[model samples]
Target chain A: MFIKIDFQSETPIYLQLRNQIIEGIAKGHFKPNDSLPSVRQLASDIGINLHTINKAYNLLKSENYIAIDRRKGATVLPLMDEPDMAFVDDLKKTLNTLIASSICKGISKDDFLTICSKIYDNFREEM
Target chain B: MFIKIDFQSETPIYLQLRNQIIEGIAKGHFKPNDSLPSVRQLASDIGINLHTINKAYNLLKSENYIAIDRRKGATVLPLMDEPDMAFVDDLKKTLNTLIASSICKGISKDDFLTICSKIYDNFREEM
Candidate 1:
């Protein structure tokens, strides 16, 4: 698994790690049932604290992105086919903020949609 | 000014307040140069701590969504016509995570773009 950490970024290291893993999974770098590196190994590889890596893993598990097994540790779960109502609501709330910020920044509707389309296409290509 | 806080939410209270204020601005409930309620007033209104509201206001100021004056307190700033390169980079990083999550949730490209278009249109209507 490939991961990069920017120690200087305002984003917490654990959250950054979580986002990178999700991006990696989306980009086809990690497949369903693929085992993730153990917390100790990943901590050494990324040169972060073991507790930070553990926090990231715990978050991922809670979010249903991955599952932990007694023997295999953490493995990626298959993509969910239907999002729950709560997930949809959360997505809308997030999009609301982004859209507001974009409008305030004077991003044209065409430009904004174009960016969304392009990003969506990038993920589609991986499918 | 209207604000709602869910104590049960996983997101921090300060962030929820910040996002709601941004959404309010985008929806035209808050015009450029409109004065926000004092931190004390808003905190009491929403029944949250004054410190939490202060934190949200400070973050909005740092993001240039609002400005703090000695006497006037925090006032909304006019939207910027040009986003800085750093802002664009941050926007892309956020979109990347959102797009990846959408893909993993089996949201089709059309559906995703439609959602984006609808939200952008909502902001456009307020202009």
Candidate 2:
């Protein structure tokens, strides 16, 4: 339930919040059906505007990472079983840029894959 | 030297242009020291403002992906030998979000690594 915000970053606060929440879920810090802090509580905890927290929640909801209800508030959703083609395409485009930059930096394919595997393994440790 | 612009994308035109150029380099469509179209020409070709193209070029220059000179216009820079920590950190963060989503989608480690290797090999074909 800890979200760190860097005010100096060029990235918007709401996007940062959303990313961290997603990362938190990936790290197993927030399991499926886990309740997130209410908008007022999170805003107070993070010392940010309530609307900013609301925006982040709405975005997460739109992406199917979480759901909000009038009686229960906001909670994490179980991971979707079906693959999202749109997300896969978007991920490939992003990976292309990172791979391009790594190539420019003289990083070999083996080394890059090693790094990716190592990072992925770190997440598995949490599970 | 063809750059396709998607007007409906949520991504900014300048950023899309920058990414496509980087991907072009990875795909060997543009090689080391290759000259890019002048800002005016590209702007006219893409039907966007000159300043947008200028912004993208400046960003590329700042990232060391390309260099701009008064006489030479803009040209791709040779790959750097040393790794950039800041860039690596940024890439790791992005990859984390991607890995998170992939895990949620039930993509296995082997599948993910296979995809990475295949994409890397595709880039190598250009060389």
Candidate 3:
């Protein structure tokens, strides 16, 4: 439920809210079936207009990231069973960029492998 | 030079273009000092309005991903020496979400580690 907004960023407020919520859900901060704060409450908490929060919620609904019900409000959706091509393509592009930057910084192959192994081990330890 | 516009997405076209260009630079598709297609050319290529392309270009310039020269045109900028905290935080958020989804799907820790090692090896081989 902790989210920060950057008013100085070029990205719009609604997008920032939408992205953070989605990222939060993905990162295990928000679990499936978890009810997010009502749009009004979230708007008040974040100090943004209710309309902006509504815009973000609307986006989440459209993206299938959340399900909206009149009585229950919004609930997190389960992750898809199979990854979409678009998602995989986007992941590949991001990894390529991240790897390129690491290499450019003189991080050797062994060191990079060590880092990924650490992340992998951390995941196993956590889950 | 080939870019497509998603007319239906909630994301604004300008932001989409800006992200794509930044991702392109990170993926090594665009080299430093490599001139991007002119704003006019890009606008035509993507079938977006000139103003929208200009907005995207303006954002890239502000982010230091590209330098616009009146006489020389827009040139790609080199990646930063060290990853910024903000960028790393953003990356963590994304990776956490992605990993959670994979785990939820029963992708074992071993399989996940294999994937990362593969990505790491690909980086070394490519570089």
Candidate 4:
């Protein structure tokens, strides 16, 4: 549930921060309405730039993952609204490419399902 | 499967081309050893830039999905080798973020698996 950033990773810093925060939510590290560290606090804690945390927070806000308030910094939102058709379509598109590649490499259907199950279960505590 | 391009889509063109080809292989539209059109020919057929087609083909080659030969141009490869740990790890990392986001949005494990099963079944022909 800790925020760890790999500066050398191919993924951009903001995305890394965003993903970890989301994962933290999924793993119940941060409950709904829990306060997140201010961007300045996180920047100092992680030794990352203030701009990077701001970007990540902004993205999370745009995606409805959090709300930015001047008094409370960023607050987690439950965000349990049903996904729209556009979300379903986008998820399908991404999974299509991933499944295609995995199939080409001979990942069995059962194996693929098992992997999905494992990852899905990893976030079960939150639900 | 037919290759269609949405120029208005936010996804880059070359990625679109590459994903479609991979989908083609997954759906049995292109079998092992099947000859894909040369980069130039595909560029002409799709009305895309030669560079875009070349980039897609190059990515396919690097991923072991196809082979490029001067004599035969590009040929579909079976690419049935079991994925290594690195590939599995990468898949886990991506799925983690996606699953986390979906969970935060109130998608259930059953719904998630059903969605995954639907997509994975889509490529059953190739397997």
Candidate 5:
């Protein structure tokens, strides 16, 4: 429930929240059927605008992370299986774009893979 | 330069452009002092709005990746060194947040690290 916001980060706040929540769910921090803090409460806790928190909630809803009940508030949904093929396809497209751009920039395939490997190794999480 | 836009990406288009340009410079696709396409031209080429292209250009300028000379248009700047400690620190903060959230969600540290290592090794590039 302790979320830090990097105001100066190039990433948008809503994205940060969405990613954090998704990661949280992936790691199993929130159990199925658990209730999320009310949007207003989360906004006050995070000290961000309500609209921003609402935006995150809306995104989560779209992704099926949580369901909104008119009177009961937002409740956590069970984590789904690994990302769908559509999501994987989207990821491939992004990586392909990045790879093509790197090639255009003169980054050899070897160097590009090396950098990514280094980053992955350096940041590997202990699961 | 041809840039593709994903209307459905969670990331902002401007950010995507900024990251792509930075990576491009790192890979040497653009030489020092190369001139970038004008906003209108780039927008037309990419099939995006002029304002979107302008926004990306503006962000690049702020990051010192490009120089905007009123009459001359946007010109690429010399490639900078590896990211500074400040940038590294920011990246660390992000990863730490992701790790902590994962831990909260019941992801084991070993598993996380293994996933990261696999990603790194799988994607490692040759210099």
Candidate 6:
């Protein structure tokens, strides 16, 4: 996968890399159990700092988005068997905050839901 | 409004203040053109640093969420005349990233949409 980093965005490079990798997972670019390129390889391939790629990978690992092996490096984790209660709580809090901002911006509830539905479907479960 | 600060959370205090005020607007606790407490007054009231409140208010100002006046201090702006295209674009990007993480966590699309619908309607338009 060609990871595009927006040099001009104010967002830190590691976070951009993190979000894109999560996006890649959602878009089925990296299937369950798929092996991601090694940190060194990805760094050289994209001209990003090795530290940046490592940070992104570590974040993904901590989030349970990926698992790292001693020798095998990084691999995508299978979807959780049950939805995590903690994760759901965090999701509600986040969505609530985002919806509040959207409401203040005059976005109708329907408009917000339409966007949510569209994005959810954009990540079709090809598993 | 009684503002609560969770120092334990990693979220910055300023952004938390910003989100709470936006939540206040959505919940109708703050009406259109409602005058917010002056920086000094709110800082004293909430026991937060004046600089933190100032940062939050300035951010709100930049987002068109509030207006600052020489005499009035700060006031909530009326809902946008029309949705800002840039804001909608940002909304899409943020939602896309969030929804991706949800999908990876075994959150079915239906479950995700239901959450969105619930949060959206939770902010009833009392205007």
TM-score of each: 0.91, 0.95, 0.60, 0.91, 0.59, 0.95
Question: What lDDT tens digits, residue by residue, belong to model 3 across residues A1-127?
Answer: 7989999987789877877786666556778899989988998898889899889888988867889999998898886666555655655555655555454444454655565555545555632
> Which ranges in model 4 have alpha carbons more than 4 Å from their true place?
A79-81, A125-127, B125-127
Clash-forming residue pairs, model 2: none
Chain A only, candidate 3, TM-score: 0.71
Sorted into a CAPRI-style docking class, model 3 comes out as acceptable
Candidate 1: share of reference interface contacts reproduced: 0.71
Residue-level lDDT tens digits of model 5 in A1-56 = 95777899888999889877766655556667888888899999989899999899
**Which lDDT tens digits does candidate 1 get at residues A1-118?**
5899999999999999999999888887889999999999999998889999999999999988899898999999998888677777778878889988887877777877888888
- Pull out the clashing pairs in model 6: none
Question: Count of backbone clashes for each model?
Answer: 0, 0, 1, 0, 24, 0
Which portions of model 2 show Cα errors greater than 4 Å? none
Clashing pairs in 4: none
Q: Write the per-residue lDDT of candidate 4 for residues B33-56, one digit (tens) a residue.
A: 999988888888889889999999
Report the CA-based lDDT of candidate 1 relative to the real structure: 0.87
lDDT of 2 by residue, B1-127 (tens): 6788999999999999988888887777888999999999999988899999999999999988999999999999887777788877877888887888777766667877888888899899977
Model 2 lDDT per residue over A1-127, tens place? 6899999999999999998888788778889999999999999999999999999999999988899998788999886666688877767777887888788777788888988898889889998
Which regions of candidate 3 fall more than 4 Å away from where they truly are?
A: A1-34, A40-58, A77-127, B3-11, B19-29, B40-51, B78-127
Worst 10 residues of 2 chain A by lDDT: A79-88
- Scanning candidate 4 chain B in windows of ten residues, the lowest lDDT window is B118-127
Task: Please list the Cα RMSD from the true structure of every candidate, rounded to 1 decimal place.
Answer: 1.9, 1.4, 5.0, 2.1, 6.1, 1.6
How good is the docking of model 5, by CAPRI class?
Answer: incorrect
Give Cα distance to truth, residue B13, candidate 3, Å: 4.0
lDDT of 3 by residue, B1-127 (tens): 7566689977689977876676566556787889998888887877778889889888888767789999887898876766566655655555555555454444555565666567667644532
What lDDT score is found at residue A7 in candidate 5? 94
Candidates' C-alpha lDDT: 0.87, 0.86, 0.70, 0.87, 0.65, 0.88
